[model samples]
Target: MDPAAEGTTTISPQLAERAERSDLHTLGIEEEYLLVDAVEPRAVETVDEVIDQVPEQMRASVQHEYLRSQIEVASPPQLELSSLYDSMRVLRTTLADAAGRAGSRLVAVGVGPASGPNSRLVDNPRYHRMRERFGDLSPGQGSCGTHVHVSIPDDETGVQVLNHLRVWLPTLQAATANSPVFGGHETGYASWRSVMWERWPTVGPTPYLQSHEQYLTMIADLQASGAMLDEGMLYWYARLSASYPTVEIRMGDVMPTLDDAMLLAALARGLVATLVQEVHAGAVAPDVPHPLLMAAHWRAAKDGLEGTGIDLATREPRPAWRLLRQLVDYVRPELERHGDAELVTVLIDRLRTRGTGAARQRALLAKGTPVAGVVDWLARTTRGEM
Candidate 1:
């Protein structure tokens, strides 16, 4: 069955829960990009043309997103961290050149502009059904995001990992807030994409689930209730992959630079490894309440890295960056074990100096650079040209 095909009424078969844990954690990362007019900075319907220009060898890795103005690329799963970075850099450069040749620029933005005409749906059956069912929600569906897929041993392990991963969803959101400006004005929220994405009934930090049986039952219920048309529409922040033996952490907006993206990819892998280890040792995952997690998600979207985040431990506000640091410390040993320690350290420092993508865009606007300038800077940084 095609994962993207809509109208499946029942959940698909998956590996049994509680399979033996495999030590090796491979990584596969996907990033969705927006195609913008080269000069005016509005989203343009040129993804089909740009995709046509991709070299034959890389075609398998690239595909259309829900909107005509968006494209997505995924790296093949790999155990080596350094090689994965090189692979993504190549994809971005290749796609950027292809977009430029098609008279557009590839931007690593979260949400497309609200001022211009809405992006057209991708010319496909699945997308049309989505537009028909979701109504106004489809208009802003051009939002781009970075999805990290890390190998898991089995569905039961993946479900357990999802519970462990839920606590960090807000931290990931705060670090990757990139959609500050839409409609050529400040939206007052750092990751406006997160706000928009929540309109879907299934999208959120994954709920605390008891077993793999519950995971299957939940999807079946959602599908029967019309809240979801297929398993592909289960948009939890983290979930068991339907197509592969992996746990997918897909809560982040696309980062502005490759370094930012790699930092997130590294963190996702490290966190998963740490959690998996804990699971093997019979440790209980945190008993964080759903209400607190929801509040934390909202606060992170409001503040990004520049303001306060809810410390899950204390349920009180702390500097968002401090929370980010606490996360880094928590996963440092796992990162070291995965040989990602040195690279993550350098990337985090760069983030400290450069700030979140939303912050950089705001800084450009504060200097009297128009929205077009912000868009151009985003395009340049996306291709590592600056």
Candidate 2:
């Protein structure tokens, strides 16, 4: 039932061999998107209706999100980046078509472009309890984000992967930061979705941990402290997935296009693959100070790729683009091993040349387009029509 299997593209045999070996580390992606009115371009509570319209064969891949106005679609894990990319593209196109049939547009971004209700809570007991516990911090519907999951061999290795993945987060955040406009105007911060998302008690960077046992201990402590209602609400920027044997990185806003999402997916898989090797080689995870790491996260969220960020290595401000390039270099061998170095390089160049999602949204707004028009643009671009 893998959609990517339907339209397989032929490739060089040498790259094909690498891609075959790359299956050891699979890639999975989940994205949350607002269901907005096609004309008014405001959040609409039609996720249920939209999901209902999904093709019967693809129903397993689509579901409701935290908000009633939000829907989520996950591409099945793929052993190869090309397959993962193809499946995701099909999923977006299919889900978007379903939304169109339901009279709403599925917008892929961090949050809605316009203001919405204080809460559009989905009708579920767990969701209700969360609302009771967090109140206004819980959006009835919530901001959108792209969650990338790369398979790890085991839990212990997953913990180590999280550690290695930490230093690269700020760069990833800057690379994918998309939410710039909210309430119909500029929010000043590059990723307003991330800014607003941090209002919740559990969301943000994860603390460096020693082992898988420690990872569980921390979660149990958070649950006992009332910061988390359940394991499902861990909400760390990156964590070991509870439902799957994968390291889930949820730091970035939902990228507006298939190519953008694939960039993150490829890098994530490469990072996980590289880190797993180090794990076996008995390499120590870099222990960055928590406060400094928090500051780095803040800078990336505030400025995105266009702005300078704190270089954790030297403890100095450097262009986010430079950090991103260094990250690519750090994982180049793994990218090559996965047969994705070329594609990843091309995507990185395209992203840099066009600017991050936040920059793109700000650019349109600067031209005096109404927020509604921005919403229209979001819809079109998300549908890959732009």
Candidate 3:
């Protein structure tokens, strides 16, 4: 044999172990919201006042982003499905109450209702430095989204789990699509947040990687090239968490209600858990390329469910509603495993019929009311007072 051939190793062992236990389900929700003055339609920075007035527990979990107009609410790590929903509901309620005391409201805007030069950045020193470093990354402007974290055993599983999820993320965005307008202009995108985010360094589909080592190598390469500062900047459409041992689904635009938020979180957790199980059982998944998925994502941002979406799996055009219905049934077993079938059914019925938050926002804007109505509507829906 040749010297080079004799020296090379043919195979690599498993980078990590499969998650053995089934009761390992853990979930959390991250809600990015806008702080709005009840009287003004624009975003305002009020995190300080809101946090100060809220209960101590909430104050601890609620954090400000680079923009003062934006605040992120994180649900406590939850072992049970009900607990996840409860934490989200309670947090929203507490924040709403606090906003009331401050003469403001914690409004959830996908892409804010109104936009102008009046937006205020959050006043934290760290945020200030962040704004300086990453000028446009912060919401010093306006846009919001919902992120769901589902804990996995380790990084290897996280990569495999996120790879499987990349295809359907655009589908989720189409179903949850909101943010028809941006900067107060009718941009014509169903989810303007998706469009606005393309300006960021990392906001698109992730290429298929076969194993954990391949995934790590790609990440290391990106970091070495100075394209990314660290693992934290690997903001692929669906990605393994650089910090948490969880998979983060960052597709859905900020929803107006707690029920919608909880439902989305449940779906995310269930999907990840099911995929993790399948990968553990020696299942080999098919390739869904990033370029094709990016096209689908663009369609989702432009038309939402109102237009035909580019199917990532088939590489063809299909109706958004048809695709969504199929996924609901396809994921039924997983939903059942998580004891969330009932809630999933309710969400499907509502989403399938009403279109999405973007559709509703368009209707409200057409009714001759000002953007303030949109802000109030969001506040009401989130508190379940609608």
lDDT of each: 0.85, 0.82, 0.72
Per-candidate TM-scores read 0.94, 0.93, 0.88
TM-score of model 2 relative to the true fold?
Answer: 0.93
The number of the candidate with the highest TM-score is: 1
Residue range 55-112, candidate 2, lDDT tens digits: 9898878877777888888887777789888888888999999999999998987877
Candidate No. with top lDDT = 1
Rate residue 10 of model 1 by lDDT. Answer: 19
**Segments in model 1 whose C-alpha atoms lie over 4 Å from true places:** 1-22
Pick the winner on lDDT between candidates 2 and 3.
2
Query: Any residue pairs clashing in model 3, and if so which?
Result: 67-122, 68-121, 68-122
Candidate 3 lDDT over residue span 1-386, tens digit each: 01011111111122112123455557677787877776776776677787788887556567765466676777766656787777778888888898889778887767676775645665655445545655766443566788777878778877777678877777788876778866667778888788777876666777778778998898899868765655666667677655556787877788887667776777787778788887888666667765677888998888888787877778889998887777777777878877888888887787766657777887788896566677678778767787
lDDT of 3: 0.72
